[model samples]
Target chain A: MHSQTPTCGSIPPVPARAGIGGKPAHYAELLAARPPLAFVEVHPENYMGEGGPPHAYLEVIAEIYPLSFHGVGMSLGSSGPLDRGHLARWRKLIDRYEPALISEHIAWSRVGEVCLHDLLPLPYTDATLKLVCRHVEEMQLVLGRRILVENPSSYITPKDSAIPEADFMVEVATRTGCGLLLDINNVFVSATNNGFDPRAWLARISGHLVQEIHLAGHATIRSGELELRIDDHGSPVCDDVWDLYRETIARIGPRPTLIEWDTDVPELPVLLGEAARADAAAALSESPHAAVA
Target chain B: MLPLHEFQAAMASYLSSPPGPDVSHHLKSMMRPSLRSVERRLAVYKNNVYARLVDALRDSFPAVERLVGEDFFRYAAVQYVSITPPKSPTLLGYGKDFARFLENFRPRRIFPIFPMSPISSSVTSKPITRQTRFPSASSGASETATACCCIRLPVF
Candidate 1:
């Protein structure tokens, strides 16, 4: 069995500042400009290949900056058994890069034989919660690190759900010894979509458990009589999300925030600009007078 | 209370093949608001499953997709989805079998490789799986595989 936690101590920790999602377009400029960044977050699954340019670029970048492996698969919510092979591959990446932080969504992507290539929300029942907690524990044990579980944005809620999203997450974290990657944008999107208060949602989470933060752009479109906010990290961060993020920083004290612009990725300067904006916001929250604001 | 796996099974049916007459009544009870609202909500997941997976195919095989033309590419994508919906979370290896699909694709080969070339036959084999490497030749310009990444799952 793989060690429950990483045995090596090679990579440095990420600073609690602003950074961008590691996109290939910004690779050269990221190295050339050497933007002031806390760290870069990459989906670890993308680097699972035996050898390729992704690994090549990531190798050089890993040496320079603190890395975070944000995983999208592993289907933690599945009723089916965990994929041991997938876990081994992920462990390989973690062992090689020794990322500062690692995280996955509080959702399922597969059940039995079917693997839907998307993050599907799970019903927040005791069974489901326990299921996720088991997966997180297994993941942490396999990788030998307490990984972070992210709260997912939702367009629909399950009728079987009896627990509030925040409480469910808190239980998942507390039980598994995992931390939270509070994507403030998801809070706003999910709350707005489901008719809840974002502030109260944030307040519900145990803030101390939050290890890192994700700030990203979402696209809102009308769904029948409803307006659904899709977590499409394509565009610039909107004003409302910025407001929530700034407020979150005030509460959480600037956890390593990542400005995630995944789709329709713009130039490095544009992403750097967003990171700068995040820094400025963090700066506000850190100022002595920030509390007054 | 609905059994967790059963709820997921019903959901899987709803998303994959669409529920039929003898569908789970628990599905409607499991949702809120009205029946129409339930459908509107469910459609999001249904659309997402097909669209995202199709997009994953479109992403991984962009050059081939372009060669086959948009409509035909979309046609092939839908067929692939129906036959082989992603069995894993990551899209990393989701479309690994696409070359096999293209091999039997019936349409003219979209890839630049000529029919005469020996590499074309083993498009689905492990040799082509890891960039086309002819062992006989020491070092020269080699045909590189597409660098695949997109969608929520960049790997499977």
Candidate 2:
């Protein structure tokens, strides 16, 4: 079993600023410009392949900027053992890149040997909670450091759910000692979809447990009478989501926030501009000007 | 009250044989009307899953869809789903068998040259090549076999 040795000794504290999902199209210009970004977040799956452009570009970027591995396919909530192959690959990447942070979703994407491409929801029951905690413990052990688990933007409420989302997450963190990657946009989407208040959800989870934050756009789909916002991560961050993000950061103070634009990825400047906007908001919240506004 | 396994089995059956009359009867007793209006509404959920899966394939393999045309592509997709349901929860990783299905599908063989030319060319140009390595049947059986083996070779 792998164990975490506190590597925080030599590593600088994670910056309290904004960054963007590192896309290949923007690699050169981003490195050349070295625009004011706290760090870059990458989907570990994209870099899971052997030596290629993804690595080449990431190597160049990592030299000048901090990097975080935000994985989408670990299936941590699955009712199965951890994928040894996936963990080994992740371990290799971590060894090479030494990302400032490593995170995965609090949802499952696989069952048994079958992989589900979607980040499917898990019932918030005791069985599911135990399963997820065991997986997190295995992951933390393998990675040799703590990881952050982000709340997934759910589409449907499971029939067997026995606990509130926030409470479930809190319990998981308390049990496994994993940190939170609180996606503010997901909070807004889930709250709206499930008839809960976003503010209350944020209030339920704040401070030390949360080590990072995520902001992304979503699309609203009407399933019968209920309009659920799907976290497509394919567009500009919506104004309402942005406002919720600002409020969350203001209340919680700043963490390493990421502006994630995955589908219709704009130019480097467009993404950097969004990151800058997030930085400005975080700055305002920290400044006296925010009180007046 | 149905057991969880029974419910999952019913869902699997409904998804597999959606248009079959048996689905409606099974769905009627199992699913709450409030949860999903009726069998018709349940059909919509099935449709959403299929549509999303198909869209994912189309997005990932535009050239293949373009070569087959929209109507034919959808028909083929339905057949593909029935034969090989998505193994991965991630739709992006599904449809690994579509290109093979096209190669063996007799109806599509009429187009004869469809597998090469425009479709294969377009796919090679995309950033999604990491997901699939579609083969051209015109390259002869031995070559096709070699290509298939190469494509199936896992990345990591």
Candidate 3:
């Protein structure tokens, strides 16, 4: 029975600047350099285990930079009911970390009792919209905090999907009063695979409801004659994704951007280099001259 | 068009199932028609799901992977994943029964003798002999002991 009150007390929101995903491998180096970052983001699932070096490092990191919790396993959009035990674990983690921004994907990874462990796509329909809103509201009720839901990088569109992806996400945010974590890379990936314009998807999103942004790299695989872009987060943010991020920030007014490199995580400096690029790009986008020109 | 749960169930089955006529039928039924082939689109999710689960197993049992090499390990992992899909939401501590799975894994009996010894040690650093002596006879009790043993023996 974890307490609902935040033990860490009130914390400030993550600033609208660039941050890097907090990887365990880079803990020591990150502590040593103490690079100037707006915030540091981590997947709450990684820290859900018992106390160890993960907690030890996160404790110190949280003190220096505003922390954001990007959860991958909440299965918020599942057809099944929300897992109360998993929600309890999330509650415990939130009580301890008190991340400035908390987020989960608008995708389901579990079916019945089996956890598939991938951000499985959801059918865009009235039923899914209502189910996701209920889950988001339930999550907020448990954590006592409003969370941002992220759009998934999709490959296949279900035949049953009735609404468009952008409209579905906006509806979720609108109904639940939850914010949106707009991943520019995911938009590019899904747009490329599903034959939709990424810019058009962005246009449908309400900028006021967006709280943070994500920029990551993807892998391109040739499937027959068609190319598939996978949001693996394994490489540097490509030029196309950067352009999308710049345009997003320029339009959305600079949310707390994160440079995510999960798979094949590189050294600290390389990640920091990406974060620096995000900062530079955001600065350029925010500049009046660039927007005007 | 399938309902949400029915759609997810079909998608789940397709992700784990081997590519064949059955898979082709499943894809065409559930997926929307597009310029790209349905098989190709479904293959992306299949790769992501299997790769993620296989990587979790690899992380838990590095010694098994080393003894069997990447290709064989992947082959065994795919089989194990098909038989025993993950139940936990988080990947951490997800593949505890993998060492036991390797013991009965039929294709590569040649590599079985080396896996349980070093792999359990690799996972929890506990000696297998010491753990096997404890009273863990309940359901999934053996799996718990084998999954994260507390005893450690040097890998010979």
Candidate 4:
């Protein structure tokens, strides 16, 4: 096995400021403008190919800014064994880029032979917790790093779920010595849809364990009288999520935050504008009287 | 309660199957009580799974999606996804068999006139994004603390 820590002497640490999801649409402008940002996060699955424009673009981006490999296809919550080949490819990319941070969802995407290619929810139980923790430990052992596990946005909560989502995340982090990537929008989405308080969920989490935070836009899907917030990440962050984000910063202090615009990715300025808003929120939170407001 | 694997297995089956009373009944036992219709809530996952893969297919085969209108393409895609779900996490070549599936889905369509060679070339080459003018290389080195990170198992 390679050294537990890959040779990352050259990469800068991600600053505790706002960043945007790395998109191919904005590569030219990103390179041209060279916006004042902390880091850029990308899905490693997109760069798994051997030699392509994705690598070429990422190579240049990696050279300039700190990178966070936000993996979407790891399927960490699956009950079965982790896929070794996927792990190896991820290891290869991590070794090459030497990103500042890395993370994956608590949700699973693959089941048996079927790769659903979407993050699916998992029940929270003792047995399920053990399985996720084991998988997380194995992932850390293989990659030689303490990866952050993100909370999933829920549409359906399993009846067998015994542990609360926040406690489950804390337990996984506690047991595996990993960190948490708190997606604040997901907290709000799950809270609204599942009938819970987003703030209480945030308060339940161990703030120190949270290494990074994600802010994304969600869409509301209404069926008859019921309206459900879908974590679509295709628009600007709503005011409610932004309020929660501000509260989180005030409560836990600022972490390396991200503006995730995956589906309907806008121009670089729009994303940069959102990042600026995040920075503004963090700045406000740091004020001496921020607690009062 | 069902074992973890059994629950996930059932979830996969339920999500993949068509949304109907029978399918909703299968998942009703697993899901918690909600104020809204359980079927609508469950449909979110089904929509997410199908929509995500369909978007991936559109990314891979934009020409095909264009050749057959969005509605037709989506109609065909749902059928293909139902019969043959992706087996790998790497969606780069996930729809390798889509052209073949299209052949079977609508044999009478104008597939013959379509330039199969270029589309195949595009797939093998795999250039998903437009070419960007890369800036001149600037080498800058900075020092910071090192931290390792990991996540769940993944398949290529």
TM-score of 2: 0.79
Those runs of model 1 whose alpha carbons end farther than 4 Å from true positions after fitting are A1-11, B18-26, B34-36, B99-156
Once fitted onto the true fold, the runs of candidate 4 whose alpha carbons sit more than 4 angstroms away are A1-12, B18-24, B106-121, B127-156
Evaluated at residue B50, the lDDT of candidate 3 is 69
- TM-score of each model, in listed order: 0.85, 0.79, 0.88, 0.88
- Candidate 1 lDDT at A255 equals 82
- Output the better candidate (2/4) by DockQ: 4
Candidate 3: interface RMSD in Å? 10.9
Please list the residue runs of candidate 2 whose C-alpha ends up more than 4 Å from where it truly belongs after superposition.
A1-8, A288-293, B1-63, B74-78, B85-97, B109-156
What is the iRMS for every candidate structure? 7.9, 10.8, 10.9, 9.1
CAPRI verdict on model 2?
Answer: incorrect
Question: Local distance difference test, per candidate?
Answer: 0.72, 0.67, 0.75, 0.76
Q: On residues B97-153, what C-alpha lDDT tens digit does candidate 3 reach at each position? A: 777787777876665445444245344432111122223223211112111000111
- What DockQ class does candidate 3 belong to? acceptable
- Score candidate 2 by DockQ: 0.12
Model 2: per-residue Cα lDDT over A13-116, one tens digit each? 67999988776566667767889888888877666544355577779889988998888778887666778888988889988998998889887655555543
Q: Which residue pairs come into collision in candidate 1? A: A4-A144, A5-A144, B90-B155, B91-B153, B91-B155, B92-B154, B92-B155
lDDT by residue (A107-141, candidate 4, tens digit) is: 88778878876677798999989899888888888
Q: Which window of 10 residues has the lowest lDDT sum in candidate 1 chain A?
A: A1-10
TM-score of chain B of each: 0.58, 0.65, 0.68, 0.68
lDDT of 2: 0.67
The per-model DockQ list reads 0.26, 0.12, 0.26, 0.28
Looking at every candidate separately, what fraction of the true A–B Cα contacts under 8 Å does it contain? 0.36, 0.05, 0.46, 0.45
